[model samples]
Target chain A: MRFLHTADWHLGRLFHARSLIEDQAYILDQFVELVRTERPDAVLIAGDVYDRAVPPPEAVALLDDVLARIILDVGVPVVLIAGNHDSAQRLEFGARLMQSQGLHVAGCTSATPACVSLHDAHGEVRLYALPYAEPAVVRDALGAELPTHEAALCAQLDAIRASHPAGVRSVVVGHAFVVGGAVSESERPLSVGGSGAVAAQAFQGFDLVALGHLHRPQTLDGRVHYAGSLLKYSLSECGHDKSVSMIELGADGSVQITPMPLRPLRDLRIVEGALAELIAAAADDARRDDYVYARLTDTGALLDPMAKLRQAYPNALAVERTVLARGGVAGDAARRLREQSTGELFASFFREVADAELDDGQRGALEQVLAGMAAAQRESA
Target chain B: MRFLHTADWHLGRLFHARSLIEDQAYILDQFVELVRTERPDAVLIAGDVYDRAVPPPEAVALLDDVLARIILDVGVPVVLIAGNHDSAQRLEFGARLMQSQGLHVAGCTSATPACVSLHDAHGEVRLYALPYAEPAVVRDALGAELPTHEAALCAQLDAIRASHPAGVRSVVVGHAFVVGGAVSESERPLSVGGSGAVAAQAFQGFDLVALGHLHRPQTLDGRVHYAGSLLKYSLSECGHDKSVSMIELGADGSVQITPMPLRPLRDLRIVEGALAELIAAAADDARRDDYVYARLTDTGALLDPMAKLRQAYPNALAVERTVLARGGVAGDAARRLREQSTGELFASFFREVADAELDDGQRGALEQVLAGMAAAQRESA
Candidate 1:
């Protein structure tokens, strides 16, 4: 059974605070074109359909239109999930009604695993959907403490294993920060309060694991694979080849993943040099037509780095200045300063801006303000 | 020839800084219900299906679903337009393809009016869609120099009138701020730098002119009318009797309007008083049950009004100290403030904040910043 395997759509999301709706639509169009040509039996969208729990109206409408075009108009069946970024309740809305139309959206609280058993002339293959769920949620669902991203996923596998019994071919889908996976720079550090690591044995029972939430198309193991996002969402994910994993499940339950290149809408390219050199290089490089994320390191300041960059490349997504560390300092103080807790640095900045040596009374006032803000945060939470 | 007239749906909108998706859905549900029960031959949504040019994805999807249900499930025909908030290009996208499906979306630059004639067993009613256009656009469309929003609108009306040389019963649809009409605070102020008003005489010859843009449901000289937005978008419009003006056109060219209430999912009430009075009043009210916007007037101080209000009404959109015009002194100051240029005010504000007089260099800096911003605005224009 051949199907287009992809996940982490992250629709309605921004690329570093800028709206990426147009870029996303562009990538999705490629996928739709691919579907139109390949004619896969079903399209498997692993998870992260949206960037946030409460997606903007544009995001929602864009997703809806894309889904309508794919599932309803294009004559293709789709199976999707909710990732960590998704509000499972909101994403899974209309799931029950939409399911009848062969569009499966399995978010949280699946009573049993949503098994889409499709049969070709050869045999039946079961596609098991295990959307990203916290270990606590799994524990509540199964009435047991499956206390890890991997553990919760393993529990789902156990259930799927039991149902398959003697000899049924099943492929598992999930969104998780797996232990053995090579994560792209953009993937959020999954550890919550220092328990980020998870056991690899969690998916021991699965024939094949389709993973998401990591935007690097690769196999964690030979069987456990990631399809990755269609495009780079952040400059942190620079130089990663974006693609969809097309998986073919054989009659005997063997699975082979063939990576299909998602047509590159843009490239995240970083360049470091003096401002003049950088400007000259940018002007020379004609690839400015593509989306570019650039960083220019210059000792002396240019009049306006943005203005200079835009002179050559009008659509530069990002441009950051990197002033070398002063004296014996190793590197850019900006990056080092950013590494510090933003609040702490902000307070220090405020002190500098005020140009007042903080005495006991001033320090006490600053501490009081910080304490008040912290208290407010706690109250809101 | 009865039709449901509604406009400024703003499908994906944020009301009082909170998402109005659920409220929009609730109101739309009523519309769907009205369509089903009343069984109007045609539904005329004058314009502004979305709040912004790029609405949230969910908003787009919800609108599509709602429109679908009305057209397909409810068995009603629809006529629509693009409002000031809309991108004409985006709204008109795929409109040409959907014309035969009983859904008429008119967001084009055609000089000749495009009419959608709905014929039932009783008779035929023609709908003339004239999406919102400024004077320059109207002038360009008609190859003339139109001077006013009224003139621009009049050009469209002339076209619509020209469409029906046979003189069949017809209704003209437009999205413009008509002069001498009662508008709520939620409606955008169109003419900040120019005369933003569309003349009443623009729709002089039409049997019924279904208007959009202005959210307050009202008739212009009893013929041209706006159905109004589905729900209140701001606390300033708290007491607004928000409704859709249901129009029933007879066999002759006469029309009747019935104001159908759009019950919000919850009431958005703003109780203005002193802190103590507000707290006392909130105690009796279901503070947690509804969206609230409050302004508390106090003699001297308000110690974190947001914190206090949030303690009782958790979802308070905003809370401000309403220092209501102290014996008309505030009004005089306000008038004087308005008279001062932003640059002058900017310098004054900075001087007050710094508690010092501005130096020549400081004044130059402030002036430069304001001038730069102004230049950028001009460039954008």
Candidate 2:
């Protein structure tokens, strides 16, 4: 059996206040082309089809168009689940109705995880879809005391395991923060702390564990895999080699996994240099249309540096002054200010502005004023 | 062939700033029960499935639940279209996939109208669904110069007629304001003027024209019918008899229409009397829980009447002073003031306040001040 695994489309996402709909549409067109060429038995989307609980209309249309092309035009079955970013109820609107069309969606957690069985020469392979659910939701659905994501996921997997026939090849698709998985700035935190992280071992029994939420395509323990996001959603993800996974399962349950790289219409990149030098280099740059985040090392103030950069790199999204970053001049100044006492800092400021040190009499007067202010504050307290 | 025809659900609608979701859910439960009992061949929801283009998540869930129950549980097919209030693209999200499950949706106007041919004992009855579309959309889709609702409807009907097989009974579902159809305040005006009203003759060829947009349940020329909204959306619709249409189509193209009344959880009503009397009467009122719009006849001031009314009628939504209404003392006073010149009105007010008419000398001083003010106003203009 052969299928493609992908996730984190993040349709309707906005990067630095600019809509990525056009970029997403372009990449999705390529994805559709890939599906047409490959003719995979089924396309498995782990989760995070949308960027928010309530996405804009265009996002809905884009998903509709893409799904129509894949399911109706290409005649391939699609198995999708809802992520933390989707409104499960909204995503599951036509789940039952669409089942006949081979579009299976598990938007909300249920007592029994949604399972689709496909057949090949080896017989049947069951694909279990577990949509992202909070611990509370899992607890309510399963009537279990799941205090953490791991507990919730464990309960869900247990349900799937109990339903599966022994000795049959099976796959589980999920959205979670797996332990030791690389993180990206664009991924929303599943929980406030480490409690959201689940050990990859929880998915050990499955033939293949397809995952989402961590926006870096990678393999965990050589069994669980993440397909990553379709595009670079944040500057921190500029280095991510975005791709989908093509899995070939043999009759004896041997698995062969291949990474299928997705080429984005405009690549995201971080360019670092002095503003003038960056602009000069951009004039000769071939990828001028790439989404750029500029990190400037220039010490002095530059007038409308972003505007200047846009002249050569029109898609420059954001700018950060390296002087203000950690280990730079502004950081040093802030650290020094944190160590200084109020009196010493005031005296130093006076010296700088007045071009002279404070006299003893002036210092004494300042001390008296400070003492009075402290006394007044204590009284109020 | 028999089917239930309904429209203008306006799910997620808020009445007097309060969500009507609970009320809607209760009524829809009864609607589903009716469908279960009747076991209609198909259910036709003409349009306006949502109150807004982007509905709240709960509304989406409610629609999902309702459709699931109707299609999956009750085993009835449903044909729904998009009205002006819906975002066509968003509403059309799983349309193609859902079609096989007998959930036909026409969210956007296309060159070909969405038609579902249902088989009955007599033969095939073609139901053509024409979702609400602006004149521009119709023009673009049909490549015709449709400048008004009538022209657009004509073009759409023409397309349906061209494609529809002759000698077959048909029903055309639409969302539009038909000429001479009684309208209530709850209905949004389709256009600025009369251009939005289509002629009843435009739907003459069809066996029955199931329509929406008009919140009142009425028949135009005994052929075009509106199912009315599920609930009274505005105060002006308090008198509307809300219901869905149950149509019986015969092989001879004969039609029998029946209004299946829907009982709301909380009825909307206008109660009139003095503030104290209304409150007193509420003590013995059997339906105090109903949504009340109180019209107080008391001329004097009352303290927080709405708050007080809620003690007896917990669902009192609004209060109005009948004294301020037309033909009351305030209205008579306003009329008298409109007739009086500024000088005459001011003199009368001086007499009422000071217990003395303006003396000639006082009048002369007032006239001079008024003249100076008028001159300044003229200069500014």
Candidate 3:
């Protein structure tokens, strides 16, 4: 049995205040072509189908168009789940009706995760789809004491196992920050601390664990895989090679996974040089349309260097001054600033102004204030 | 052939800053009961399924539940369109997939309005659904000059008529402000000027014209009808007899219209008396939970009247002081204020302050200023 595994499409995402809908569309077109060529038995999209809970109209239309092509036109079944970035209710609209047409979506967390069965020459292979759910949601749904991500996942898996027959080949599709997985800047932290990470061994018995929520495609224990995002969503992901997983399962429940590389319409890249040299190099550069992040090393002031860069690389998204951070007193200060927490930064400012370090009482008060502000920010977020 | 006609549901609407979801749900339960009891051939919701372009999650869920009960449980086909308050693209999501299950939605304006064919022992009856569209949208869709509501409706009806076979009974479902229809404060104006109103003669050829937009259940020329809103949405709508229209079509295409009254969970009421008397009356009132707008006629100062009123009428939403307006100089001033437009009020204020009638130039300048402010406010709104 063969199936395509992909996740984190993040449709309607914006990069550097510019809409990436066209870029996403370009990549999705290629994905459709790949599905048509590969002819997988089914396609499994783990989660994060949208960038935010409320996607723009064009994004909704794009998803509609793409899904129609794959399901109705190509005659392939799809199984999708909602992520933290989606409104479960909205995504699940018309879900039950669409299921007959081969579009299966699991949006909300329930007592039992949505399971789809597929039959090949070897017999039935069950796919359990667990949508991204908060610990509180899981606790309420399952009537279990799930105070953390691992507990919630374990409770779900236990429920699935209780109902499962022995010796059945199964796959678990989910969205989480698994232990030992690589992280990127674009991924929203699942929680404030270590509780968000689920242990990799939680899926010890599953044939294949397909996951999302981290934007780098990598294998863990040769049984779990991340399909990564459709495109490089952040500058931190510049060096990452984005791809989807193609899973081939044998009659004996052995899995062989292959990474199918996707070519984005515009690649993300960073260029470092003096302003003059960078402008000169633009003359011979063939990929001027690629999204570029410029690091200016020139010490002297330049007249609108960003405007000049855009003359050649029109997609230049950001610029930063790195001359002071290269090698100087300012460089040491920058490094120290990067290393210090908010409380430490405040303590250093206090020492500079009062010529004294913060006492234990003052430190405790400051920490309380900082924690309150952080909680407030998180609530608003 | 008989069908139930309803419109202006305004799901997710807020009345006086309080969510009306529960009230809406209460009334919709009765509507579903009506469908079950009447068992019409089809259910037609003319338009205004939501109060705004983006409805709250609960509203979406409510619509989903109601539609599921009507279509999936009761086995009645529903034909719904989008009103001006809806985001056409968002509402149209999964529309095609839901069609086979007998949920027909016309969210976007096209060259040809959505047509659903129903049959009876006599013959076929075509229902043309024209969702709310701006003149610009109608112009683009039909490649015609639709400069006003009348032109747009005429163009759409023309398109429907050109292809409509002769001797076939037809019904038109649309969302627009027809001429001679009463206006209410709760209804958002379709346009800035008179162009928003369409002539009733535009539906002369159709057997029945089921319409929305004006939230009053009324009939015009015994042919065009409005199925009023589910509940009173504003203080000014307190006197509205909320109901749905039931149309009975004979074999010869003659129509019999009946207004099916709905009982709301709570009614909207206005109470006029001194604060003390109003409170005294509330003790005997059986419907204290009904939403109340209090008009206080007390001449003397009262402390925290709203708080005192809430003890008896917990759902009292607004309070107004009407003592001074009942008699004397203040009464005259209040009456004048009610009769004057903003420009007239400004002109009167200028006369009182400057002891002069404003010159033509000054009047023109003031008019421009008011126009600019109005336009700005509209844009922001």
Chain A TM-score per model, please list them: 0.84, 0.86, 0.89
Models 1 onward score TM values of: 0.64, 0.83, 0.89
Given candidate 3, what's the lDDT at residue B376?
46
Off by over 4 Å in 3: A325-381, B324-381
Deviation (Å) of A115 in candidate 3: 2.2
List, residue by residue over B186-269, the lDDT tens digit for candidate 2.
776665323378889998789988998999898988778899999999888888889988999988888889999989999999
* Candidate rank order under TM-score: 3, 2, 1
Identify the runs in model 2 with alpha carbons over 4 angstroms from their true place. A193-195, A252-254, A274-285, A296-303, A323-381, B193-195, B299-301, B324-381
Q: DockQ score of candidate 3?
A: 0.58
**lDDT (0 to 1) per candidate:** 0.73, 0.87, 0.86
- Model 3 residue pairs with clashes: none
Chain A TM-score for candidate 1 is 0.84
Q: Write the per-residue lDDT of candidate 2 for residues A1-381, one digit (tens) a residue.
A: 998999999999999999999999999999999999999999999888999876877999899989989999999999999987887878898888788898999998899888899999988899999999878789999998998889999999988888789989998989999999999888876763233899998987899888888899998887788989888998879888899889898887777889999888899999999998998898789899999999999999899998998998999998988777656677888878965656778899999999999998988788657655543432222
lDDT of 2 at A330: 71
Ten-residue region with minimum lDDT total, candidate 2 chain B:
B372-381
Higher-scoring candidate on TM-score, 1 or 2: 2
